[model samples]
Target: IRILPHVHDTGAFFVALLEKVSPLPGEKIYKEKDAEEREAGESGSETQRVRQPPKKKQRTGFKEEPYFYFEKDEPIWPGISQFYDMNPEVDPTHFLSRTNDGKKRNLYFTNKLVKDVVTLNQDHIKIINTGVKVLVRSDNKGADCDFRLAQEGSQVLLPLFKKRKISITRDDMVTMLLNDDMCEPPEIEKMDTKTQEQCENLESGSLAFTHKREDGVEITLVGWKGAKSVRGYVAKHDRIHYLRLLNADTSKYEKNKYQEQRDLLQKNGSIDDNNENSNEILAENGTTKNDDLENGNITEVKENEIKNNENVDNEDNGNGNGDRNGNDHEMEINKQTG
Candidate 1:
């Protein structure tokens, strides 16, 4: 029955009453209001009390809950160490949750999913969504090259991986982060020649590269290896941030030093050897000597090449005497040919 404010003509309220069914103690019978009794309105006096039905029972939803194991004493640390230097202090069970058995290949995690996962284990609790994905899988089925880290995970793991042994240089770091594409693994020596000898003995697994600039240390992760290339991945925003770290102040000093040394070794004979390079550099800067004469020389060269090509084509496009084009074009040949 709808309830109305008796005093004024204000907004009316809707009252929907759902009938509750309670099963008998012994028998498997639920006691519900008879349809015939509900149709016929209450004939009893107002003094006689009316029994209001209880609220409908909510769904438990426990069946749909996934099987989650959060025990800390698992042997997961050793397996993950093959890919990343696993920190035992930070509980991996809290964040890095696995799906099934056998290395739990389909691993998933996020920042604030801890509380959500806990609440999901409860009755009638639900989870809408989680945070960033961290998929670390392999291309094949078996254990050849299985420990591959994804690009998205690299952003968070780069700093942690920096402390580890596997790393690359500033120049190599820049090239690997050109895009999300897989590139040739950065040379170990170029990263830091005198850093350490242990850098050379790198394995085909998850690796991180760092470039320490004036601003900050830029890092990117590389994964997998096949066909003389590895799966190098980095975020675009991270790359742009690191690119600003390039030290541009000492450029003039380095260039002048290089030019001075090169000039000292130059001689009259050596000048001709490097003249083509000098001409290219000059041409790029819009410096052309004897421009008209150079243009005429290029035109003559082009005409001579074209005439030679036409004469060669005569055999290709000709039958015996008359040409295929049937045009009265004379063949250009050298007079000294005879």
Candidate 2:
């Protein structure tokens, strides 16, 4: 039957084992060395080795041996005359094992397989077989006290203990760490005086007014409440008006009649004294004309009365003569007698 070998660097003796053996009846089965014997042998102590038990016959076609052991550097193979040392108490399942000498431990793979184990002493240790180069780190004091076993050309990760919570995913933290612009805050724009006035003039409790210039151009402004009155007429060249409301007493309408009369007289070129004298002369002329008319009427009345008295006397004489003529001849004799 063919035998296969598996070898690895463990900084100790390279050990190999074989299993699945067939043995004859009443023949002794192979046995490997126990830990006590191996320890005695390593120390060069001479002692009687224990003998193996003979194999017993079984109903099966062949009986299997438990295991057969061999050391690679040693020249023995399948030789059952002497027993090979084996560490029964040692846990083969572990990646590392301590030697029987108790001076050091051997890596199951290699010293480098265990990370972060620095070499503390050089003479106390040995490297048997390794897949890669082994680096021996030494301090200046020449007494190394630590051992670092790891894969060759591989990085070692040190154990780190953090005492505080770290922010790993916050956007702000990431931005700040990266020194990016994402952490900058937006800027606010400032308002100018004109803009502020316009805003104040807005219907939202803002004071504002419009002013007209001499060229008829208009401008609006905002001011404090009750600061100034905005009611006034603009002059021809003025751009603003400032009329205000106030309480003032009003007077009644009056006519200057005396002044009017004086003006009329002046226009006519006449004085008050000249006008009075002219009116008096006119009155005198009217009185003289009325007296003359009265005198003429009295003289006509006297002439008419004289004419009437003459007529009356003539009538009386005529009547007396008639009577005398009728009685003249008769009355002569009577008259002579009387």
Candidate 2 residue-wise lDDT, 1-338, digit = tens? 32343355434444566785777678654555667879777654444455766788544322321111113332321111111122333222222222322322223322333321313321233433322321111111211211222222111111111111111112221111222111121111122344334334322111223334456653332211111111111121121111111111111112265664444444334333355653443222221222223212111123345557667887787853666677886788799999
lDDT of 1 by residue, 1-338 (tens): 76775567676778887786865576443355556666876554334344566889887664442434445655654566545665545455544443445555534445446646654654545544443345455434322334445555566545443333344556555554442311123334444454234344444444455445555654455433322233344444444555546532233223464574444333223444565765543322222233222212111123345457667887687643575334434323333353
Listing every candidate in turn, what is its Cα RMSD in Å to the true structure after a full C-alpha superposition?
19.4, 69.7
What is the Cα-based lDDT of residue 308 in candidate 1?
70
Model 2 TM-score relative to the real fold: 0.12
- Of candidate 2, the 10-residue stretch with the lowest lDDT total is 156-165
Query: Model 2 segments beyond 4 Å from truth?
Result: 1-95, 108-140, 153-338
Residue 129 lDDT (model 2): 34
lDDT of 1 at 13: 78
- Regions of model 1 farther than 4 Å from truth: 1-57, 62-69, 73-77, 101-122, 131-135, 139-145, 155-165, 179-199, 222-230, 235-338
